[model samples]
Target: MDGFSFFIYAFLSIFVIVSPLSGVVTFISLTSNMTLHEKNEIAKKAVILACIIAVFFAVLGNKLLGVFGINVDSLRIAGGILLFTIAFDMMHAKISAESITEEEINRSQEREDIWIFPIALPLLTGPGTISAVIVLMGTAPGFQEKIMILAAIVLTFAISLLMFLFSRRIHRFIGYNGMLVFTRLMGLFLAALAVDLVATGIKNIFPMLGKLV
Candidate 1:
C-alpha cells in the first residue's frame, strides 16, 4: 500500500483499540467511587498494561498460535463469535461486568490490583482485538508497515489513557445518558467488524466459492 493507505490503516487501528466510548463506560464503572488521584494512577497502569499486551501479540501472536496447534482462521472464527456476543451486549447497553461469573467477580474483587484483569484484558485487548491484530499483521506489506501499526497502537492507547484519566469531566459533559448512546454506537461498529471477520475467514477457507459465486 501507499502512504495514504498506510495512514488510514494506522488511524483505524488506533481508533478501534483505543475505543474512546468504551473507555468512558469502563472508567465510570471501575472508578465510580475512587478519587481523582486514584483514577489517574489506575489509568496510567492500565495504559501501560494495554501497550505491553498489544506489543506482545503483535510480535508473537503467530508463534503462540503454533504452540497451541491453532491457525489464523480458527482464531478469526472464535474471535468473531466472542466479538459478536460482546457486540450484542453493547447494542443493548448491558453491563458487561455484571455478565461475569459470580465466582470470577468475587475473585477479582478480592484482588488488590485490577489494572491488568478485565479492564485491560477482555475489555480492551480481548480475543477479538488479538485476532484482528494477527490478521492485520499477516496482511502488512513489510516490517515498516508493522512498525507503523505498532506506533498506531501505542498512540491510540496513550490517548485512551488520557481519556480515562479525565473520565469524570467527560462523563459530566456528555452525561450518563450520552455515554450509554455512545457505547451502543461503538458496539454496533464492533458487530459490523465482527461480521467482516467471519466473512473474510469463510472466504479464505473456501477459495472455490470465490469463482462459483
Candidate 2:
C-alpha cells in the first residue's frame, strides 16, 4: 500500500485494537467512586503510561525478538491468534480475560496504584495491545512506515485520553446497550484484521504458498 493508505490502515488497526470505548467503560467503572478531579488525574496518567508502553514496544520489540531468535512472522501468527480470541470475547460483549479479570478489577478498586496496575498495564495496554504494536512494527517496511505506526499509536491514545476524560458523559450518552453494539462492531473488524495478519504471516513464512495463490 501507498503511504497514505498504509497510514490509514495503521491508524485503524491500532485504534480498533485499542478500542477506546472499551477503555472508557472500564475507566468509568473503576473510578465511579472517585471525585471528578481524581478521575481526571487517573485518566491522564493511565493514557500517558499506556501510550509510553506501546511506543516502547513499537521501537524496541524487534530487538527483543532478535534476542530471543524469533521471527517476526512467528510473532504475527501468535499475536493474531491472541487478538482473535480477544475479539471473540468482545463480540460477546464481555470484557476479555486477556486484558483483565473480574477478580483483578475488584482487587484494583482497593489498590492505591490502580492507574498503573489494572488501568495502564492490562486494561489499556494489555498483552493483545503489546503484541499488535510489535507485529505492526515488524511489518513496517522502513523508518518512514515505522514512524507512521508510531503516529498511529500516539493518535489512538490521544483519542483514548479524551474518551477517558469525558468517560462519564460518554457512558451516560452511549448507555450500556449502545456501548455493547459498538464493541461488537469493533470486534468484528478486529477479527477480520487478526485473520489477515495470520494469513500474511503464513504467506511470508512459506513463499511457495504465495505462488500457489
Candidate 3:
C-alpha cells in the first residue's frame, strides 16, 4: 500500500481494536461527580499518557522482541491470544482481567488522580491494544513505513482524545445499551481478526501449512 493508504489502514485498525469509545460509559461514570475542568484534565492526562506508552511500545517493540529471542510470528500468536481474551471480556461487557483488576478498581476509588491508574494504564493503553500496536508496527517493511505507522498511531490517539473531550455528550447520545452493543460487535470482529492472526503466525512458522494460506 502507498504511504497514505497505509496510514489510513493503520489508523482504522488501531482505532477499532483500541475502541476508545468503548470506555465512554466507564469514563462518564467515573467522573460524573467531578467538575468539567477536572474531567477534561483527566481526559487530557489519560490520552497523553496512553499515547506515550503506545509510542514507546511501537518504537521499541521490535527491539524488545529481538532481545527476547522472539519473532513476529511468536508475537502474532501471543497478541492474538491476548486479544481473544479481551474480546471475550468485551462480548460479556466484563472488565478485562488483562487490563485492570478488581483490586485495582477498588484501590483506585481511594485515590484522587485516577488518570494514571485505570484510566490511562489499562483503559486506553491496555494489553490488547499495546500488543496490537507492536505487532502492527513490526509489520512495516521499512523505516519510512514505520514512520507512517507511527503517524497513524498519533492520529488515532488524537481522535480518541477528541472523543473523550465530548464523552458526556457521547455517553448521553449512545446510552449504556448502545455502547454495549457496539462493544460486543467490535469484540466479535476482534475475535475473528485474532484468529486470523494466529493462523497467519502458524502458517509462517510452519511452512508445511502453507496450503492453508
Q: What does candidate 3 score on TM?
A: 0.93
lDDT per residue for candidate 2 within 60-157, as digits (tens), equals 99999999999999999999999999999999999999988888888888877888989999888988889889998987888899999999999999
What TM-score does structure 1 among the candidates reach? Answer: 0.86
- Candidate number with the higher lDDT (2 or 3): 2
Residue 4, model 2: lDDT of 88
Candidate 1 lDDT, tens digit per residue, 1-213? 796688577657546534666667665666666778887887888778877887789788878888998878777767677777777877887645423333554466545586777667766666656776776666577888888778777777878887888888888899888987887887787788778777777777787875575
Best by TM-score: 2
TM-score of each: 0.86, 0.98, 0.93
lDDT tens digits by residue: candidate 3, 80-180 = 98899888998998767877766877777767789988888898888878888888888888888888878888887898898889999988898888899
Candidate 3 error regions (>4 Å): none
Question: lDDT per prediction?
Answer: 0.71, 0.92, 0.84
Q: List the residue pairs that clash in candidate 1.
A: none
